[model samples]
Target: MPKGGKHVGKIASKGTSSLSIPGPPSSKPPDVTPSVASVLDELKSVIKQTQEEKEVGEQTLTGINKTHEKVKNEPRVSLYFKQKLQNQYVNALQAAKRELVLLEQCLKKVDEVKVEIGEVQARAAPPSTRNIDDYRSKMHSGLGTMRRGMLMTVLQQYAVEQQVWKGKPGESPPPLCGCVPADEKYRCKPADQVAARVRTEDGEEQWILAEVFSYNSHNHRYCVDDIDEEGHNEQRRYHVSKRRIVPLPRFKADPLTNPEALFRHRQLVLALYPQTTCFYRAIIDSPPKEVAGEYSVLFEDTSYPEGYSPALDVPQRYVLPMRETKKK
Candidate 1:
């Protein structure tokens, strides 16, 4: 069975309940607060120990099966000896299976712990100063509301196509520009829409909308331009590793024809912030109930004391399924 498979539903339900609106901020500091790095170190240790135990258990089961097979095939072996060996194999195999089961549970717990850690970290970290300034500027200039309204209309019209872009459960979403051709020599081409991981001034990486500008074959990196820039002169560019780039989906999935394309309430996602092309981590407060309805999402924003942005309505084109965590 897949890791955490048994706990998937339970976890989702718990997440929904726990993510309530943020309460008023308290003046007192949290007592005995633990550093994120320290906590991560402990989780790392637990994961390592559990992985080792699981491997050993699997090897033991394999060895027992092989030994039993050999004993059964050996005609020269006496019946009494064969029976004794079979009894031992049965006991050993059962014990190994039990151990493997326990290890799987341990892994599931680890994943849950990781999610908790992420929540805490996101809440504690402050929003980017530059982004805040830009947002304030737009609002002051009376451009933010107008831009958001126009964007929402466009997104609503493309809702069906947006749904199809997301990946199925336990899978990575398709690239924004669609999958690269199997025979293609390069993963991306100039002007292709994609998401690139860009590091902010505070040393945190965020996935943002970008367009491929050029490829550096020597270093296997793509030079991409930020798509959110209002003017060509103000646009920023970065040379990112091929692995850090995800192509946008070129096709759409119609929820009318594909029920699976509809997102579930409380599902985690990457949503485009209002009046911006940047995507941020968010949770689906509610999925659209009608074809023309919008998704209600709560974005992770440290600007709020509760570490989450106020619930906002987003069009399907602005929301994508959360990316899968990469294995080490």
Candidate 2:
């Protein structure tokens, strides 16, 4: 009986030895490394410092200018003192100019850094998240809301001017070449992907994916090739008005930094029709809070008596700003 009890005890000891309680996972914080958030914080600090320096430099320049003016206009000032003050003024002016140049360069560097960060974020994002609308939002994210709105208004005005000029006889169309300074802000360049408004055989105008083949400088129009003509023996092409083309955005907008990128409720926009590659005029019923979120829109449809389709949820990539046109 004692031998049996010893065998049982040996089995119990073996079972106890086999049991284990894992020690709590290592509580050490992750190794410190440069991250996107850290870089953004550093950039913000740099911008703030540079802006402050710029204000100070401007103030100093203003003071110097005031003194220089006073010295030049004063008749009582002796020649010796005038000459000395003039030399000092010239030196100070040059120094101030140099400082301003440096500050401008610093601000440009900050912009470059922001662009790099955006590219990194875009590359890290999932493939499904990449799209033209997101790119457009990102490109304009730096602009203030009021500025963006004004830009849109200007574009709409240009569109109107083009339309009016096209109907005139023997008159030169306004230059849509966008060759001047800040040209890109006004016109789409060749080889750029654009959403071009096309009139179908049914006379319905729909926006479709097209590429700018070439610009007709004489007519102020673009020769665009339809992107959906892949299976056709001959490629479909159109000579589209500059006013009818909307360039696709080329970068992803950071939602946190650019809330203005989101469409406003009730704003007119172009949205891809479900189960179709064609884009159509739509009204924003509600905008998504995040860049990745979907937009609720009511697309224009002839079949509906109300002339608008039922509210549909469209992905951010499929929604874009409507081609602006002047109302008659």
Candidate 3:
């Protein structure tokens, strides 16, 4: 082997880093391998299917056994008839047994794959939060490349806006062109632009407007931007699941356009229930219905004076749909 090849092997065996030495200056980029996330996803899908098959096999066996038991208990049944029935049941039971064995093998294979993936993650993952930042950078680069023209225009405008806003002497933004890196799989999806309820650290709950942004396919989480009544707030971009947010009441009303007005309305609702955040349990109450484009919900705000009941009669535009949470 060449001298460089020997060094490469030594470093690789030591597992010092995931990076490999590149070829001389003219060499192409290294080939990418399948990500652990994709492999694990496939394995999980197969395991779920295998479990379903196992359940079916067990059910089949149970039904066959029940039929066989009933036939055996019939005192007037003929010997040949009973023998035929037993033979059929036996054949079915054997088939079910074979299926069960196959499913068990599939489960074993799934376990092995999971262990292998865990090992790969341990070996390849970085020690700090840098990996997440890198992932986000890649996603943005990919999007920029795919949307070169539009993204470039936006970038230019953003630069001019920054320069004008900063008013720094001789500190113009860098010039950009329409050559965004291509990101084939990562597509920007429209955010869920609706008002919802969220709790603050102090346990005080209030209604906030929010929009869905990009999604992280690897982590399977939503990049949500919580738009306060003042509009899009950069500080509120968080990775949140659907369960943490509750839909707002949509009494007979139009969507509020002004941020200040929206904020004030939100405050009014909070004032009605100052003691606690909004709560909608799955078992407590049925979902509100839209009647003539309006929704009627009972506000169980404890902040109200004793024996004071507040009901929400509003338009459907005020209520946001439930966000779907994926099974991890």
Candidate 4:
């Protein structure tokens, strides 16, 4: 061992660093030493093991990413709660009606109480100028009745719209496309366009515009869905059910804006209610690529005013419903 083995102290010397080549230990038994081929085989085995581990690591990362994506793109949970909310609303309506009935009894009681109190107060002290006047009370009393009537009238109008716009005319909006098609009918030209709105399962609402990119025999249908609350503003579903789903609104009696107007002039476009929002790589501030663990996404901006914003941010996913640039 001493004869063949090199000393570490001598190797550490800066002057001897270039000249040193440490040799194997000369042990007493030669049979215990591994052959050069065997040593090479061991190194190869370690290299192969490392490669296999690397492959497994990659596959694991891939699977985890896929699972995350599925969850990210899934439909919202709001739809499920909506029905229960409607049930509660019906219960509230019934309770309100009951309360209104009770209110009649209460009104009689209140009148009696007011009369008695007024008599006592009149006897106890002279009527003050600050006391609520009878006329003002009467006016305030009618407000609740007027509110109920207004609500009923609005509901009736919605019913009428539903009857008239039940999937009328035209096919559903087209699915998000990868590229602008060449066929004039399906191709989205500023000149040829129609906008519409619809209520979603959640009772929230959204507005959408359908402009054909080009005409084709097998043109894919646009996916749109929405909801509304208290008639305040629009709300919509990100993922529209795939089918020929149409909208409640129709082309205006007359164009709000001229044919050349992009989205601005059209009163509806100015009211741009995008029931759906598509996040393309080219457009939006936070595209999927920039957000590493992100993906290209489509979401419905249910709060669209009306036809305010066109479905401007179209999804750039797969080329859904492949069609030719120029139709045959």
Candidate 5:
């Protein structure tokens, strides 16, 4: 079983409830409270003691074997005497085995306790500074005319980034672009999705999930959040041309186990002129032919463009529902 297997399972079974997008995973290091530290220290000591006990048990078994060998090899030993000696050796060996088994069980329990303590620490640590402020603003902003779906989706992505579900913050906010207010470029418009070029082990580059931190409005250069395919957050930023960054599809945050699941089939609006009111009517069954990981979707529109087909290739973050962007 996984460390958080039960928790993940519960989230999966509950359907999409508040628990699904609860607080994002914390990017800040876990706080080691004094009590937790003390508990860890105690566990370490217990492990040491159990190890010692196991060694002693092994020694006892060795001694029993030697004694039994000597008694069995003795010259002219009577059958009754040999039988009695063998019984004594068997009893000693069994006792030693029982002692070793008990010590092993204790060691296993100690590991379990350690993992539980770490989990508690992770759960207790607060979200990063940005998430706290963002969440606070959302709360205080009058609940009047709330776009519950949009708000939820925004929060989920915020949590994922802050908690670092798929990527980590760049080191020092990528050198600020003097031409464009670094702050302005960092802002991801509701219609835009952040993307970056990632170089793989075989010298191949792929565009993957990214968070834009800085952009040079003057030179068309951008500093984007760089991540590896395995989802481990990288500290370096990818500097690239403006054209390299692709927009993300619009999506609602679903309580899914991993980043991939969260990005899978979702309700999205076609990036067509927002005026036409184009939306993906159903979750796509699969991606377009020969294009892995890209969603192939059909749009529902009251009014259609002259050259438009019912199908298009859209990534999860790129799809925006018409309703969310109407007032923008």
Candidate 6:
């Protein structure tokens, strides 16, 4: 299942009206005196531990408390699993989610063209026969096409997101709230639907899922990364468990699986999850040559303009800008 699959930070629960068996209370005077400094020190440590254990669930928090039991004498501060750097992280998560699916499909499935090489022989041939030109030609063949789809998908997805965020044509965010049923939503994907993985001849890359999160000005960005503000601590432990109803990519059985399902699943999860939304920047590159090795998408941020659908042919009478400038 997607790591950190549970909502990181959710609304705190109100107490249930359950009887405590009406046990007799102790007559001893309550020792109200507490070591504020010591408790505060321990609280810091607990917070530190809490921050380290994100993208995790209640069980992990339980274990963390156990490890820090030595310092329990100190006053305890509640730990919550709140979202952090929400806008950038959530957008990054979605972008990562989309490209991940595309990359998996490109790596696992073969192109319909169906060309094969038992092993490429490093054969020396005449320059005219095979050289840089031939190498470029091979890129257009069978497997190349499959890889190209994924690369293009990543690039296009990035372009669309960039445009939306950068105020370019396609850079629009998904709807603000649940205006429509998640299943019926046009661009918004449901959470259980988003899961993606990439596999090469050797093995698969780590499985990942993306969900939305929100941010407020009160939280510290650096500290948020170290904590889940919804409080995954002993005092506020969440009992959320993994549900198998919707199979994420990691949990899927082999054989029936395909690249399409993973992509579809991951996309749905991101859209459906009701988390806060924010914005961030990212860079995406065209996919690498599959023949070289099944490298995953290489994304990084840059100031360059988002890509355009390259014109297939040069426009007639198009002149160089440099030439035009010089003539002027």
Better model by lDDT: candidate 2 vs candidate 5:
2
- Clashes (backbone N, CA, C under 3 Å), per candidate, total 10, 3, 13, 31, 10, 34
lDDT of 6 by residue, 1-328 (tens): 2223333211111123211111112332243113323333343443333333322323333444454563466575334311322333455455444434433333223221011111112122233223323332433444443332333232222212211011233332222211111222123122222222212123433222222122223431110111111222211111111210112121211111221111221121121111211111111122113222211221112322433221121100110011001110
Summarize candidate 3's per-residue lDDT along 130-220 as a digit string, tens digits.
2223323333454543332332232222222211111133432221101111133433355444334454444544444455676666765
Better of 5 and 6 by TM-score: 5
Question: Model 5: which ten-residue window has the lowest total lDDT?
Answer: 1-10
TM-score of each: 0.41, 0.43, 0.26, 0.15, 0.27, 0.14
lDDT winner? 1
Model 3 lDDT, residue 211, Cα: 55
User: Runs in model 3 with CA error above 4 Å?
Assistant: 1-188, 194-207, 229-235, 242-291, 305-308, 320-328
Better of 2 and 5 by TM-score: 2
Candidate 3 root-mean-square deviation in Å: 25.3
Better of 3 and 5 by lDDT: 5
By TM-score rank, best first, the candidates go 2, 1, 5, 3, 4, 6
Decide which is better by lDDT, 1 or 5.
1
Return the TM-score for candidate 6, rounded to 2 decimals. Answer: 0.14
Mark the regions of model 2 whose C-alpha exceeds 4 Å error after superposition: 1-185, 201-204, 302-307, 315-317, 324-328
Residue 259, candidate 6: C-alpha displacement in angstroms: 15
RMSD of each: 20.0, 24.1, 25.3, 36.9, 22.4, 29.6
Question: After aligning candidate 3 to the native by TM-score, how far in Å is the CA of 127 from where it should be?
Answer: 50
lDDT of each: 0.54, 0.53, 0.36, 0.28, 0.40, 0.23
Candidate 1: 10-residue stretch with minimal lDDT:
6-15
Winning candidate number (TM-score): 2
